[model samples]
Target chain A: MKLTILFGGASFEHEISIVSAITLKEKLAGFDLKFVFCDSDHTFYLIEPAKMKAVTFSKGAYKKMPLLTLAQGSFVQKSMFSKIQHNNIVLNLIHGADGEDGTIAALFDFYSVKYIGPRVDACIFSYDKRYTKYLCEAIGVKYVKYEIIHKNEHCNITIPYPFIVKPASLGSSIGVSVVKDESELDYALDVAFEFDDTLIVEPFLEGVKEYNLAGYYANGTMHYSIVEEPKKEEFLDFEKKYMDFSRSEQVLQADVSEELTLRLKTNFEKVYQGLFEGALIRCDFFVFNNEVLLNEINPIPGSMANYLFEDFTASLEELASSLPHSKRPKVTYDYIHSISQAKGK
Target chain B: MKLTILFGGASFEHEISIVSAITLKEKLAGFDLKFVFCDSDHTFYLIEPAKMKAVTFSKGAYKKMPLLTLAQGSFVQKSMFSKIQHNNIVLNLIHGADGEDGTIAALFDFYSVKYIGPRVDACIFSYDKRYTKYLCEAIGVKYVKYEIIHKNEHCNITIPYPFIVKPASLGSSIGVSVVKDESELDYALDVAFEFDDTLIVEPFLEGVKEYNLAGYYANGTMHYSIVEEPKKEEFLDFEKKYMDFSRSEQVLQADVSEELTLRLKTNFEKVYQGLFEGALIRCDFFVFNNEVLLNEINPIPGSMANYLFEDFTASLEELASSLPHSKRPKVTYDYIHSISQAKGK
Candidate 1:
């Protein structure tokens, strides 16, 4: 079966996506593969699968791939991509903004292409922190209390001295700042306006424990790996995230205490569903005052979260080995068509 | 300024969109026009704005139209849409699924293109019924207790009889069915699944008074319109919606009581910001036992809700006059350079 890989979107996490895609492609290279990379310039290229490990776009037209656009699920190049046919499995390695969120999935749905990951609704629900909190409340999943502030509006109401500010719909910790007082609000707001109009002001959970989860949800049941405690602050600042890993205190794999692990795993699954009635998700949670409150859910976690799962000794390939060996069921258009007929009937 | 008349989409409401677009184009013909149409096959054409009124295709070469891909929002054929230069307004006329939701809005946001209606986050929140109910709850608006059923998941228990099941993310009451007994649950599930995999089951309010809202949130306050009563039995259906005049038993405008109208107007504006944070929205409410409970929020209401706002004496053109004026105040980024800087910085 033909499979296409889409990576490196117009998000702050674009380069890291290149690393993740190269890692995933290297793992899956023995199979028949067509590698496609999406760049920041709103275009895509079909590169040689072997060249994914190193830079090939050094010179010549093939080096710098022509721009590709998505019409539904199929990718269209104005000149080059228009000539290539679509693949059966379109693995999305794109992250942040349109890639990590449901926007890309919506295009996939439009093309009637079978893709790997969560549905559009769930993908969208998790990308934005505003709706993510609203949903967490509905499903009874514990999460931080946050107020969404629109820049066009004004409010000076203080939520204590320290609070985490984020551009509501962004990921990879872009434009996220931990504000200490009223004096810093303007700078934070200006930084936020660069990414999104809506801002999520969340009460900082002080002196809390934080953990990361890589989860798999297929056929309605949610599965996850052992939670890992990050050696970072409750909120990872942009500098700590990318430029300076030393800024983060340290990351330690917590002991899988039976009771605590069970509770954390259960809540992680519920939070996953809350974000979007999705098929797969990766969740982050903070444990404060003996309570595990969800932080965020990543629907299109990098290269299907190979790092988090493998680090926990639950490798994706191992999971793939144990699973029932069957191709992903071909989506049925008849199911969608019958409803159209029902409208007339 | 140049304008792109974006119409047609891959939604169940595709045909209805065609009808709406043709009507909108006929009325808006006096403006500079770029008629870009999306066919059922998902092919897009950019014709002479005037000639796009009817469904006409030229000799097999995708004539007079650019093969434009909606994702990332750029045209494949520059000559076809080169007429649509920078910073032009896009009068979005599509509805249902991705079109009605914020997926397209996010794309519009990526390129800094301003369109008519709410931002991506608000549009997405309003689309999901489950989330909309929570928005109502947050703003102190009432709602019936509702539970969701997963696709193909067995009936754990027939939700108490006399309940209504609807596809969670739809408008125009397309897949709504009132089930009175356990026997009807399967049929209802079968019907609802035709539209969506996730289904919402709410105990029906047998005698609730229904009210429809058509208002824009200019400066975060909603203007009023006399509510209209539908001429249908127990529940509103699709047939009554698209062709109401002939099928209705009785259709009349309801008089808003003085004290309650004042309360509703205040609360309506309150809820517009609280429940649906958008520039414009159409909400549905059910008043049970003299208490109004928000049932749903429509981010992109059909035909821009022309008929509901008709009695107010504002011509459709006047309703649309606000399109060009809405601007997304944002910072200009040297995007390519930013990609390089974002990676390094």
Candidate 2:
């Protein structure tokens, strides 16, 4: 099947998405790959695969390419009397808002475009931190205790002095702040509220062991990736995360006991089973007091989390083939026909 | 404001949506109205306001109208050199799947189109019955006891003998069955599974007092319609709901004690606050044993539930003006620029 790499959304992570698309162009060289760029303005453009470089986008040269419009089930470039349709299955490579937050997923479903990514409901569950907490509660998965605060609400800091403040709907730590004391609380909340109207605040645990696992379900079975314990200081802030998103080399797997591994994998599967289908996602976990606590879900992980897998390309192909089919209700219009018959129209 | 009525989705309730559009064209007669029809094939067409009748869609004559494409922030009809843009704020009148199931809302939000309907998260919470149950749990609202059964799973009748079986994701009564005994269970499960992969089963209560309340939040306050007590038999089947969707006359207010009315209104507010913003939604509740239990949420109700309101057009205008603006994270490429400067690029 032809694969179209969709990148660059109207998101704060637009540049990061460009980096991911460029990295994929090198990794997935054996596939019939096509590149489509969505500008921050939400317009689509078809770019040459040879031009898949960070400089090509950073220099604003992609705008000179063919302008495309999303039609019924494909992207089309139109002339006076003819239109060229690109009907390849889209690999949603945009990292944040429009891609992982259910905007593009919904648009693609509405137009009947087949794509490899989270569906609308999955995006809804994973995109917002508050919803993720509720999902963990519903599925019996342990998550860090957090309280949500909306903008303009009273600053009731019940969690404690040292806490983590994050924008509820953002990815990549764009507006995350670790408050060390009471003096830093207002600054952290103001920064977070700049990114989102809602903020989720959780108690900051010192020296938490963080493990990242990436995988996808395909061919009637789950494919697991080696978990990596990311080596970072305190937390990954925006600059460190910007550098982290561009990494493509495989890292050393986390060294842990079999029992701990089983526990982590069990919690991961519980989170991924029914909610995440047709998408390769990464879930970060915090292991504290011999319990696995889900941190957050990366619905569209950077570089597709290719570094975590042993054979990413083969697994992607299997996932593409085993994508869930939308259960479209058979619209026979029988009721309308019966109504028309009753009216004698 | 120019209001565009979008009807006819690729859903089982496509006919009901057409009836809703036709009814709105009559009740909202004083407003500047335009009609757009989405055929079951997922193609869009522009129809004349005078042709907003069930016969126009039932006979497939809408296919002959001007073909339209959804461009950025508006719907457009294109010719050789130029395109005519219909920049009206769309009133999402399409019921069921594409309308109430977060498809159209996500598409509209992606393309920056101004619309009056449930946002994506709200649609996610209200469209599926299982998710609605989770939502009730999150918000501390009272809902009926239920069990979810997936297709191909063991047929476990954990609930009592007499219960209502419903397709989890479908709206209206298309794939709903009331099984009075074990013999009727298989047929009900089969019918419900044909419509959706998941089914939500709830115990059937005899002589349950059902009440429907419709409302929308706008201009810093909640505006509620008169609570309606629908007069029906055992349950509203497809044929009964078919006749119900086309009613344009105002429904009579339910006569109940002030205390009971307050309880219903309080539950409705809890469900609608922060979740069903920017859309007029109807909540159906069952008062059993003096406790109000939420049955389901109609995110995009038939005829916008205008029959329940005192001044439907004015409330609609207020909602249109007070629609929630998406919190777009400022995409300043500061991080990228800083990285580039550090590398001396």
DockQ of each: 0.22, 0.72
lDDT by residue for model 1 (B1-345), tens: 345666666666654554555555554445566766665565667766546533342123335455654433444344533644334456666666546766556566555455666665566667778767767666666777898888867766455889999988877787899999888888988999888778899988777777777676444235555566544377666655544311212124567677665655655676666434434566677777887777777666655555565432243334345442323222122332454466674
In candidate 2 the C-alpha lDDT for residue B241 amounts to 92
Which tens-of-lDDT digit does each residue in A1-345 have in candidate 1?
A: 355777766666665566556666655655466777655555567777767742342122344655555544466556633454555467666767557666566556656655665555676567778767767787888888878788778855458869988888777788888889889988988998788778888887778777777776544356665567766655666544543211212234576577878888888767665343333466878889988888898776655655455342233333333222211112223422444467663
Clashing pairs in 1: A43-A67, A43-A68, A44-A68, A72-A107, A72-A111, A73-A111, A122-A276, A231-A250, A231-A251
The model with the greatest TM-score is 2
What does TM-score give for chain A of every model? 0.78, 0.96
Q: What ranges in model 2 sit over 4 Å off?
A: A79-82, B80-82
The worst-scoring run of ten residues by lDDT in candidate 1 chain B lies at B242-251
